[model samples]
Target: MSNNPMNMMFAWMKIASSYNQMMLSSSEVIVRRTMMMASGTMTLPDAMSMMMEKGTIYATATERAAVAMASGADPAKITAAALKPYSTKTQSNVRKLRG
Candidate 1:
C-alpha cells in the first residue's frame, strides 16, 4: 500500500468497511447456524466441522499477522493483511448461506 497520507486514509476506510461487513456476515451466520441447530437440521459432525473451520481461519489470520509484524510492517498494513482472510471468508459465507 502507498504510504501517502491520502492513500493510507483510504486504506483505513476500506479496512473499516471490510470489518463492518465481516461482522454483519458473521452475525448472520451465527443466527442461521443457531436456527438450524434448534430445528435439528444441524448435525454434531456439521457443528464440529464449523468449529474446525473457524479455528483454521483464526489460525491463518494469526499466522499472517505474526509474519507481517516480524517483517516490520506498519500497523495499518498488518491489520489489513490479517483481516483479509476473515473478510473474504465471511463475505463468501454470507453469499453461500443466502443462496
Candidate 2:
C-alpha cells in the first residue's frame, strides 16, 4: 500500500469537522421543528379558556387550530395567526433556520 501520511490526516480532520457540524445542525433543526409544531398545538390554558369562554369551539386546542387551517384560507394568514400564540417570532424564522 502506498502511504501519504499528511494527506490522510488532513482528509480525516476535514471529514470529522463536517460530520460534527452536521450533527449539531440536525439537532438544532429537530428542536426548532418540534417547537414550531408545538405552537400549532394548543396549550392547557388555551384549551380550558376556550372551552369555558367559547362553548361552540372544540375543547382541544390542536383540533381547533386544525379546523381553522382546513377552511380554505391563505396559508400565510394561517401561519401568521398561529405565530402569535407561540413564542416564535415569525414563521419565516423557521425557514431561515432550515436553510
Candidate 3:
C-alpha cells in the first residue's frame, strides 16, 4: 500500500550499498593481515604469542571496523575506541547456518 515504488527501490539500493561497503572493508582487512602472515615478516610463534596477548583488542577493532563500514562512517576513526572492550569472552548471538 505504498505510494512510492521508486522511494522503496532507492532505500533498498542504499542498503545494498552499505552491505557492499561492509564486505569490502572486512575483506580488505582480512586479506592484508593474511598477506602479512604469509610473507614471513613475523615468525609463527611470534604471531601466535602476539595474538594471544592481544586477541581481545584485535577482535574488538575488527568488529568496530565492520560496523563503521556498514554505517558509512570514516574508517580512520573506527579504531579510536576499539580497545575499550574490557573482556574477550563476550557472548555473541550469531549462529551458523546449515544447508
Q: For residues 30-86, could you state the per-residue lDDT of candidate 3 as single tens digits?
A: 555566678856567746754674566577767977786677654333433342242
Better of 1 and 2 by lDDT: 1
Candidate 1 to native Cα RMSD, angstroms: 1.7
Residue 85 shift from truth in candidate 3, angstroms = 15
Expressed as tens digits, the lDDT of each residue in 18-82 for candidate 1 is 89989999999888888888999887886897788888888899999999999998788899889
lDDT pick, better of 2 and 3: 3
Q: TM-score for all predictions?
A: 0.85, 0.40, 0.37
Give the candidate order by descending TM-score. Answer: 1, 2, 3
- Candidate 1 TM-score, C-alpha based: 0.85
lDDT of each: 0.86, 0.48, 0.49
Report how far off residue 41 is in candidate 1 (Å).
Answer: 0.5
In model 2, where do residues sit more than 4 Å from their true spots?
41-95
Error of 1 at 98 (Å): 2.6
What TM-score number comes out for model 3?
0.37
All models, RMSD in angstroms: 1.7, 17.9, 13.2
The candidate with the higher TM-score, 1 or 3, is 1
